[model samples]
Target: MTTSTSSKGSLQLFPFLDLKAQYRTIKPEIDAAIQRVMESQQYILGPEVESLEKEIAAYTQAQFAIGCASGSDALLLALMALEVGPGDEVVTTPFTFVASAGAIARLGARPVFVDIDPITYSLDPGKLETALTPTTKAIIPVHLFGMAVDMDSIMEIANTREIPVIEDAAQAIGAKYNGRAVGGIGLCGCFSFFPSKNLGAAGDGGLLTTNDPEFADNLRVLHNHGGHSKYECEVIGMNSRLDALQAAILRVKLRYLDAWTEGRQKNATRYSELFKSRGLDRILGLPRVQTGCTHIYNQYVIRAPQRDELKAALRGCGVPTEIYYPVPLHLQRGFSYLGYKPGDLREAEAVSREVLALPIFPEMSAGQQDLVVNAIATFYGTRAFAP
Candidate 1:
């Protein structure tokens, strides 16, 4: 929602997410791609979408890929392929975007909420086995904030139970776990091309990757009204297809994704150095990357006491910050039918209250980073925001 451009005067203003500056850097390529799609009059899925599907499949090392309307739809299609329905349960963390749980509920299945690991902010594998039952249909592990989930522990637990894993890797396009891409490690990987993601398209787009041809075929049919050929009805499905223009534009941006990701990583390191030098590190809980996980830093979230007050102070100081989710999904009013109550999952509820994301876009300059650090320092005053 923050469409504000990068600041040019005195490094005073910072947008929570600066998509415009990113657009400026690749305007020519983006424009040409869009124009080509327009000239061809191919706005729906066609050669462009097919090409992107191949490129993404190769990028993630998956045997098959299919594009869809949005990340939320990708989750829905994956669930449909597995035939998840009433009397079944899908296990996932309670701290992720609503789409993770929403997809399960939409299919008339129950969503089982599990607590998250405090360090990784992902599903806690130690507690995973306790949530499974005979009717457990699948497990959806989210790669939150561009950090790879502890997939080894999760997969080991899941495989023993004979439960399939659908990875929500929307925030982690290029992130890796133990040298393997996040998408390729699961049964089917779901990715989002929302404008703010690391490898975002010009608009909404999504892709699914899987090694099973049957699963890929099911997903493709489900996304296109349950039939590969028009005017022929197979099974009940939804109307959700990726746009050709979006795929063309994504192809262009995909070329420079690694460089942009490096910029974000370097920026994260600079923030750490600044925080340590200013002793802010003692007061704030910076992100911790696990040994086998390669974090792409889609978001630079930090923990602090009185997070609300700190956010207000940062805004007053001309620094923009965002709370990834001020309220966890289980506690949401819309999901009260799920019968979850306060204190059910302590870590997720606790994290919802303390986490705040700062601007870590590739184009953010060192001066802008300095301004952010200085504002936090000024807010804490002499106590320096002690935890």
Candidate 2:
């Protein structure tokens, strides 16, 4: 409930994300969902979890959906189901969250990082061929910042090479590529239901979508300790199950996902319009939506000139901000053994130095967005941008 206030305690500070506001909006439905789950007394993979999987499958237009413990676990489960392990190589972007590549490394597979597209911040499919090798088993293209990657090119390459494509759609659950849902287009799509995700649950949860019946079956078995029948171990797997509480909560949220997405889209559009009107576009690189893709605006990240300075200035204005990632995965200390130098992925590294995310939650008001823009204009010495 604590927000930034003026010296007289009259003004409320806008947060980077207002989960509380979202909660207040849907408190009744959420509370009822939780109470129903409590009354059912089925907290494991019960009716709620089963219903969620079917609903997600229908939403994504995929033939099957498999619920798992977490988004991280979703990636790990996909890799496991695909039988991607030691000596196999998985190609992915170096600019995304660590879990994308960590899933590969965790399974003793090599994460061959490709640079990202400057416009979309997703993997540059042009560089994919160079990263591929005889040992390359799969491709994991992340739909970064809620924008879909160029699936046509990626799918063509994967099909030609006969390698599986696992989409890291943790940020793009409802995003589409050429009129197809993100997770369904790939061989298997992994989505995270982390509290901050577009379709977030109350807690940790994740799911994977696939058209392949065998892959779906394997993912279910893999997530539940690799057993077909109870106490029957068929393959070595980890225990990663989606809790019923999270699933039930997510089911309630799913009904309002489209409405929330529209709100976010409107906010994103308004921010662009505001920035342009204030002449901040010259100094701020706004997010770009691809020709045929729908951007859900999970984070309205912009590339700022002197990002660190702008961030501090915004903080003084009582407007919170976030850096989706200040460091690319290849440059991280733990991945140094991958033999990637600083200049290896120029676009990703360059973006890491300048990308700054402003507050763009679905519940954010136009006045609040104006405040965020005015703060940026003030930082740039534009005096006309008053809230």
Candidate 3:
């Protein structure tokens, strides 16, 4: 199936993500699942939703899974369950999506920003110590770009300080750290099924996982207007329930997640090999997967000195590339009151400028991969002497 092209005249050879391709592969099953939900006419919490929660919990080895409206809501609900509110501070990285910090600010809690590790592009656990204070109530470690953060160190620090660790597994559903699942290792693991994630739904969906029964119960109430029974309000809450249709769709997609994850890993290996063969290491820093961690390659980002120019060159050659984030969360205009200035987090600031995400989906073809590699090589070869 050919993808519809935009007026930009570029081939549309690569999309940031190819959800359509995945849908085509599982059309029959997905259609059947949707039909089942439609026939049941149970639009809200039902058997499908309950089954999905149980399945996801079993898959992640967690005791419970609470589905929510979106990943941001999942984070917010987790914070609410932990009783994180005004005067509390949540320590987290300054490099992830705005929602990471936004979740904290929503509860009137200050988000203490920490620098990232240049190699991992994850919250630097080593730098976390200095950021802790008397008001620190929780630590949110985001598994940025499908790579797991050093959970052992983060958990150790959290345990020492008696602070809860919330794993922002939005980009890392199946990703593992030291043989443990990303979300299952923390106090509450938050996942996003925003179509672009490793295991995505047709639309916005999220789940919070935990082994603690009380935490799970709290999250359920937190997502459903703080009620146990209909119209019986328990605690102050917000509307964030995951619909049944999305739950059914997710169940079908979940079956294919592991195989898709393997494909992504294989594509990443191919990209690395191609770059190494052309001696591009001198000009680009390839992604590195730490020992014992399984990188799902949600975004095979590379650090290139002239990232923007390289991206433009790729566009000129029918290759698609994207900047994961051009600005760090701490430096964004919305958080100016945090008083973070330039050089506050040197690593995150530097990476924000240099990091570029190439076309990397599970269904990427080898020929497409070759085209992307050749485009980069040609760009570097031509521009090496321009300046």
Record all residue pairs in model 1 with backbone atoms less than 3 Å apart, i.e. clashing. Answer: none
Judged by whole-model lDDT over C-alpha atoms, candidate 2 comes out at 0.90
- Candidate 2: where is the Cα deviation over 4 Å? 1-12
Candidate 1 runs further than 4 Å off: 1-12, 382-387
lDDT of every predicted structure (CA atoms):
0.90, 0.90, 0.90
RMSD values, in order shown: 3.4, 2.5, 2.8
lDDT of 2 by residue, 1-387 (tens): 357653444434866777888999899999999999899999989899999999999999999998999889999999988889999999999989999999999999999999998888889999899899999989999999899999999999999999999999999989988899999997999999998899988888999999999999999899998898789999998889899999889999999999999999999999999998888888899999989999998999999999999988887778888888999999999898888999999999999999999888999988888888888998998766755
CA lDDT of 29 in candidate 2?
90
TM-score of each: 0.95, 0.97, 0.96
Q: In model 1, state the lDDT of residue 191.
A: 95
> TM-score rank, highest first?
2, 3, 1
Q: After superposition, how far is residue 120 of candidate 2 from its true place, in Å?
A: 0.9
